[model samples]
Target: MLMSATSFLASQIRSTIAATVHSTNTLVTSLKSSLGYLGKDSSTSEPENQSALSSVPLRHEQYPSLQPWKGLDRRLKNYGYTMPVSSNYIAPRYPIVLCHGLFGFDKMGPDAIPHLQIHYWKGIHQALNKLGAKVIVARVPRTGSIIERAEDLHKILSTTMEGSPVNFVAHSMGGLDCRYLISHIHNKNYEVLSLTTLSTPHRGSPMMDWFRDNFGVGLLLQSEEDAMRKLGEAAKLSKEAVQEASDALHSYLQNVAGRVMSSGYRAAPNPSPISPLLNKLIPYLDTPAYANLTTTYCKEVFNPNTPDDPRVSYYSYGASVPQIPLWAPLGFPWEVIKAKEGENDGLVSLQSARWGEYVETVEADHWDLNNRWRLKIGYDQKPFDAIDMYMNVATRLYNNGF
Candidate 1:
């Protein structure tokens, strides 16, 4: 009876081993399929194409206004990106200068900290260099007016490129800077062959107008005074009573604003609590950068004064996502832009992004254009690859003989 029990146990062990082997094989096969490795036709084993085929159709059905990828090149239809860069791609004749937009930087953080060093252009510069294109990533003040940033960019290019003609591929506010440079800052030291702008606010953004109207201290105070006046009229209160109420509201708002500023100061790297006088003065600081982005300013002031240069070829591309995700950092801003300007890529509207020789709009957001948002933990599978789009930009420049 003991011998019989031992044989049964050995048989059960063999069966368990076989089951484990089968499950392991099945899991490997599933992974291969998901990665586009086990396609029926092996020749067209592009993972992006597979992903696009699955996701684009569903998205188009849900959002009819979203540009359909039906007739576009199979590779670009879904994600607005090209195939991986290969040896056959031609490099542009002139060196490509990449300009960053508002709050942009060349690099940030220390390299010693893992995943801390952030690049504004990300892997785009290296990819362009790998394709035999000389690339320069231009850095300027994060929040300076167009002219101020343009002057800085001019100085940097004049020193670095040293008279070499370049193609300006500016993104967002960077486009405005390049346009200002091309029109105003004509240093005979360097020549600009072409200016390609991606999602630039050439006309201006309604979102900026919204921010000014809703959040500006002057506007907020005016709105509150109007409300107080209406309350006095309805309640049959005396004019003095209304005035007193308005003054109290103003004082309360000032105290609240002071506390908010103090908290922000304390959160800074080296905290020195700002005095009440400085807190009051902060709102009146002359920050032209934010003011310059307003629709009224861009339409009435900047665009009228800064005309496009005839000597340089100008091309602009707009970006749009069907809808902002719930977790997107730009969700509220996207809604604001969408309500006023229809479809937008969070910050700049498609209507505003248009300028000299408008190119086709692509499927991306403002941050996606720079590959910044894609670095987040759960964003690895995003279809739009900024590297591929920039590669296509270089190819287009080469084809145009720039």
Candidate 2:
């Protein structure tokens, strides 16, 4: 059931989708596979046939590094991005890499973007370019566990930057993926000069559980573990592959990224079965193994409340957003979140987002952290002017040079 098992045949995607998704989810929504930006294609045929994607390739570079990959050069322009003119004064030699988060892609879904009037990476990339630092966009795998993604990041770094990334600006769970790479994956050979994350789920997001409660449609929207977990589970087909990838992800993140990441977004990973495919895909959902896995990566063990970033440092802009509590009567065990109230974002809580040492904050929502929105996080008034905040953060990074 590996994507590489067969050539790029149209039916191949359909068959893989059928196996990957159950009858229920397929009926409700499509499964996540080697999918591409929808609507952009504007094709009469099903996406499987029309899509030229074999999983969004992961390779990115921002600084006009010498000998950049041809593929990278094309994608940089394809994204309609270019070297942004710096503003103010921040002399940092290292450029920036803009990482995409869940639902961050230009073509995530029909309803997710376009109308929102706010795109994080594009907005920020342009902002920082004007702020002075050269910006690069990291087109990472939208689907795959942190380990898999970290490995993808490794590939991108190796090929594009020639082994070391000058800096990174990630968002959402993308932060977690990067964390796993730096803290756990241990890619010491590569040099990561700095990192800045926006609205990332440093902890897990309770939304994961919310998605499980609403599994019928959640899977199609976004996997709780995001793309990495789904891809990791799928990749679990081979343990050696899993270990190798996980090791690489951990090495790059823990070793390389940890040293260079000056700032980042933080959020918690709250477990849930939002997507039926992911829920079913979890080999150990609601079981001891599930708890063990989560616990292993929870605040206590893997990405705990530590001073990991005292040297490189980290800052956050998140607080808990209330969700109606669920009181599962007697059947559920202690492991069930059971509708606990705590610091959170619109989905992930603040306590969950807590990682590294203290930095600073504003009356911002998880999304509001970026200063680009020009408003605030609320249904009534859109958060920070997206353009303003984007420029602020980028300029700040370029100036701070952390």
Candidate 3:
């Protein structure tokens, strides 16, 4: 009986080992086939034709074990998936005009490193153009009064597109500039078909006030008040840093300002004059103009003056990324903005971003809305292409015959 039991145990052990070996072999084969398939896929097609995040999904085809089982695929069909690349399929009736906001630029840095020649709109311009959209990147003043910047934009559009009507996709303060241009500068020579603003502070930002308080009134002045302004003027500012956070110190200072401003408004019912220091500091900051963006100012001053143009169609896209450590590049200011204004896209709040036909709020920070350029600048979050957003917008405009 003992001998028979030992033989039975040995047989069971052999069967178990055989099953394990078979399973291991199957997995190894699946992995090898998946890797081989991916290698072939890469060499077979040009990089541009493929989605940036396609490799993971493409590899799954070779491995049945790795893929979702039967019914799960149907449920997840629409979730977190990218639209297939439609080459040259997104042409709009009018040219697509891209307007950059305050401290924004068309292109910056040396041409030597091709990636460093990053546009404020990032990869969207090139991608749109490839898709047969006539994309024009407007180079406006980095920091100036709305009127000044609008006039500059007027000059740019007038000179470049020869006064033809174009679809205006403005970001941040650029939306304010377009509105000003439409309200005040519309004529036979200047016409806009559509105005789409992403993360614009239609209702002014308290950050402007924060700047005045922290750096004193001199911060707002057009002339150099402190090292910050001087640095802004002299430095060839990083396009990402300019549109997003300035630096670690500035971000920390902004948090302090946000807290102070929130407390001040809570303590006082009436809006008081900005500190006497601001009065002493030169008005170079366009204090009144910047203030016009504030909720109070917009409701009182700006909205009253700049009504929507009936001819130009209006749309706005808002963004709200998860706070802080979600994207370290956006820094501490996002926390402050989130604290003061519910949800924010690092800079512009969702409420403040609302203007014209409220399109949709996306899950992206101000910078995340565009290509962070992971391969190039090392500041990227993959699978969230700003180009895709722009393409979708352009496609919609085309479908709408705009």
Q: What would the TM-scores of all predictions be? A: 0.62, 0.49, 0.60
**Tens-digit lDDT track for model 1 on 1-402?**
999999999999999999999999677556556645567754554565556545532333344333354335333523333333544456899999999998998988897893677788877777788888999999998977675688789989888888699999999999999987886554349889999999999888877766555444211223323333443342345656545644653454344342121132112222114565654554675244665577765675566656677789999999988787546677778898899888899999999999999878998889888866443343333467677688789989999998
- Candidate that would win on lDDT: 1
Best by TM-score: 1
What's the best-to-worst order under lDDT? 1, 3, 2
TM-score for candidate 3, residues paired by index: 0.60
Between candidates 1 and 3, the one scoring higher on lDDT is 1
- lDDT of every model, 2 decimals: 0.71, 0.46, 0.64
lDDT of 1: 0.71
Cα error, candidate 2, residue 349 (Å): 1.8
Candidate 1 error regions (>4 Å): 1-84, 111-115, 217-286, 374-382
Predicted candidate 2 versus true structure: per-residue lDDT over 292-363, tens digit per residue = 123223443335322243235454444333332223221122123325534444544555555553333433
Give me the runs in candidate 3 sitting further than 4 Å from their true place: 1-89, 110-116, 217-293, 326-329, 374-383
Whichever of 1 and 3 has more TM-score, that candidate is 1
